[model samples]
Target chain A: MTRIAVSLLYAGALVVLIALPQLISVKYYLHLSILALIWLIVSQGQNLIQGYTGYVSIVGAGFMGIGAYSTTLMGMHLGLPVWLTILLAPPMTAVFALIVGYPSLRMKGHYFAIVTLAFNLVIFIVLLNFTELTQGEAGITGIPKPAGWLEALNFRDREVYYYFVLAVAVLTTGIAWAIVRSRVGQILMAIRQNEDLVGALGVAAWKYKLFAFVASAMFAGLGGALYAHYQSFINPEVFGVAQSLDAILAVIVGGSGTLAGPMIGAFIVIFLPEYLRFADSFRLIIYGLLLVLATIFMPRGIVGLAQDLGARIAGRR
Target chain B: MIEILQQIVNGIAIGGVYVLIALGLTTVFGILGIAHFAHGSVSMFGGYLTFFLVAGQGIPLVIAIPVALTAGVVLGMAIELLAYRPVRKASHINAFIVALGLTMMVEGLNLEFFGHEQVVIPTSFDRVFNIGGVTLPELRLYVILAAALLIAAMTIFVERTKTGQAIRAVAENRDAAILMGVNVRTIPLVVFAMSTALGVAAGIMVGALFAIAPGIGEGLVIKGFAVLILGGLGSIPGAIVGGIVLGITESLAAGFVSSAYKDVIAFLVMIFVLLFRPQGLLGKAS
Candidate 1:
């Protein structure tokens, strides 16, 4: 009953957000909100591995690239339906995650981060140099929009797509929340705290970590597929190391452990810069400074900070 | 055969730079247990400083190299004191966060000062030396020699000096070293200084050999980490061996196999290494 209520509340909140662009007249605001939504999906995926499982992956963008390319290639060359390509991209990226994660997860701490970092570099190079297939740095342009049944419904505007994206985002968030609330989530938390203890308890820690990694890659891939269709273009930069680092930064800045933390962090990471566009060359400098300040003061993230405030209020009462 | 040898020679020259970078990273990671992601950006800053000195101010290369290296030492000390020291007692994640933040800040600083265009430090050595039909650029020869000299100096410092003994002792057992009256606080500063100087040297080589740009550091750091993994994290000899292995493997793969898959091939080698020996090629079993 609680799960149903919580999911419904989330769905309602998402519906309101979906309707926001229609209510507002600002195109720039809508654009920023769309970017926030895209980042929210990626960061949420990041939170699965880094926040829940404690394996800090820096290849979120690589997975995104995998999905984007898969969808774009399938839709463009194979002439597959958009829905089918979207379905296929996540699993494809999952396979890649498994391949990369198997050897990488053997090492702990910074080793894992570095291996994932290398994965991003390798993938980006492939995307750039594979000119015959990927069109090189020029990127694949004019990717078809989400078609068939959705297009049949005559919903093609940015407003209509916003609802579609929001619905998927909410559904994925609900599913992720459910998984985190389940026994599997508890095992992940246990692994995060102490892998040896969890292994002693008969849990195959490596398998669980692999599972989290694949799942995270799946969501990132899904987000990328959605983004490719939405943007109508696919580029190699989508899989660059900087994009991967930005996703990790979003997870860190927004709050890593909590369910809503990645979402909040996604908003700050995506939208904060848009607001600070006037800062020009100083924008990244400000961001770097903000990140340092945020980490020092709110190690737990903004969601964690909010929880602390809520606890303080309750204590005062 | 000639092409293969040429590629190998090229790889060795580039591998020398990776060696210096991996040495810097390993010292900080091995001794202090911090990932130090900003090492690459700091190295790039060193490159930019060298460019500013040699190109802008018209200083001789001899004077500029030491000045840039000195700047690196000061920057590393500042990073240890300001960014890392504050979160010494906190969760490992705090340091990780700070490293990421520092990386962004330094990169941003480089962009602000250096602009986006790739900058190469002008060198007088434009001649190519060929031996047995294999050509070696004079610049690459210098890079290789300079890297060798730095490595030797670093090895001697770590092996022979009292401070090096203290550093090794701390890395082996920090609590034991503290009990032995080794000044633990000063060790991180020293480690950072040494690491930064090594990174600065790499930056100088890169500037002369290739060019310095904004995103170049990210790529170098990834390669450095690859060396760290291939050689074994925290192993000095491992870093040297691993750096050479990776550099040579990447060049050979690019030359013989496919240039497109060079990075993939290098990582595939790392993955294979991990499969057989998870501790790395020369890394002691953890």
Candidate 2:
């Protein structure tokens, strides 16, 4: 993305985050927008790990669950403020990822995915069975919101939480962009294509892979923490197999390995199902068909297709 | 002793279904290197069709099974031609996405065609056979026998037939097979048809033994893939052994350990196997 595109995106984001809520009187749409932003943040994290790094981490929902549960538990038990707990969730997930990723990431591509998936399933099982800590499937309720300056804005408002999530989304994007544009991104991409070649070049490719895993885990954690506060109630179902597939689905649909792909993916994933409600019974059928056609024809996804169109139009000028 | 024997019997019965599913997966992955995420869903399609034939249309079990298997063959071929053939030379990810999409599409289709209820293929084999103080349900016995027969048949066909040789050649080296005048185009369809037929058979067995539902295939496919990995990605015998081991392991785990965490234990076993031999139980070390 160019500077102009970046500036325009930021401006547009600012309008949608700050101004659009005021413009749109419908409360549900604002709520949906916030949900999309949270998913976008998570997918951006997924993009970093799976798309750029080329290691299809399937435990994104696992990380998200960990983040949500940890933040919620700490808040409920330890009396930590929502803001502090949310801030603490990502790093906590990162530490967990270090242990999980260590044994799993050492394996090859698809094997790594299975391990992560197994871990995801295991985590869900733990959350369900370790009932005392997570409250099991009944879920944790009565979670507090961020009680800071936002409180003055009547943080009980969904719009305020939306803005908070939007800010986090922007921060997530900036961090991912910075990491990808630098030497770090190139090294990770290289590792994705052929880790052996990068290792031959003395890149210590394992470190980069681990970094991507941890960073992405943290990103998922942020999304989860925000989600916990936003929803005010969460359960083990949030980290389900379907949700695990959701992160990958969003990344792929929005054009994996692109800066804005995950955001676009988040948009489609969060809102598309809602929009498809019009299709009624055939909603999933259409969604599935669209997904198949999109990937088969446009492997680069919607963003990549847009880039192609943009390049064509720009070249004419 | 009877419980252990019965567990083994139960394990083999389910293992038979896993073998069929994993065999389908292993064949596709072996030949084309595509994960064929839709394989499970496709198998579900077979199961659903069998249910429709047996229950809805009132077709008898003996006749419906073959018809379902044939339909599976046709569907498999169509999937190869339309879904996979175009992207043969594209990046592996494209095909992977196609597989994922196919999975969702098939799942959606299953839901549309069959309502959100589980269906069992009604069979006459409801009797229980007892031997040496162990009891075997007639349905489970047939399932085990059918799976064994199918595995044997598949092994023979792959080993003996000229076409099987061609498929093997393609699997070993596609370019080399092409150079050797093997019609590479036809092989994928054949492989798919055969693989899918096996999957349909497995679906039929699962439907009869347990129940066929929407997400059942997904769970079955996940187990199939685990078997694929446990046995060895491309090895047929590995798939067979892996399927049985996984089935038994899951059965034992459920019996002895927590029933809810059986899937987790099964996967943990796979992970442990990976630690020892990542290439798989039967795969040659990389």
Whole-model lDDT, model 1: 0.88
Alpha carbon lDDT of each predicted model? 0.88, 0.87
Best by lDDT: 1
Query: Cα deviation in Å at residue A134, candidate 1?
Result: 1.1
Interface RMSD of each: 1.4, 1.7
Candidate 2 C-alpha lDDT tens digits along A1-317: 48898679767866766787888788898988998899988999999989998888889999999999989988888988878899999999999999888878778766677678778888888888888788899998888877856335766788777777888888889999999999999999999788889999989988999999999999999899999988989999889767878899899899989887898899888888899999877887888788877877887889889889988988899
> What digit string (tens of lDDT, one per residue) describes model 1 on residues B73-134?
99889999988888777677667888888898899899998899899999999999999999
RMSD of 1: 2.2
Per-residue alpha-carbon lDDT of candidate 2 for residues B1-286, written as tens digits (9 for 90 to 100): 7888878888888888999999999889878888788899899899999999999999998899889889888988898898887777766667777777788888888898888898998888879989888899888888888899999999999999999999999999999999999999899999999999999999888898889987898788888988988888899889999999999998988888878788889888988887788888999877
> Which DockQ-derived CAPRI band holds candidate 1?
medium
TM value for model 2: 0.96
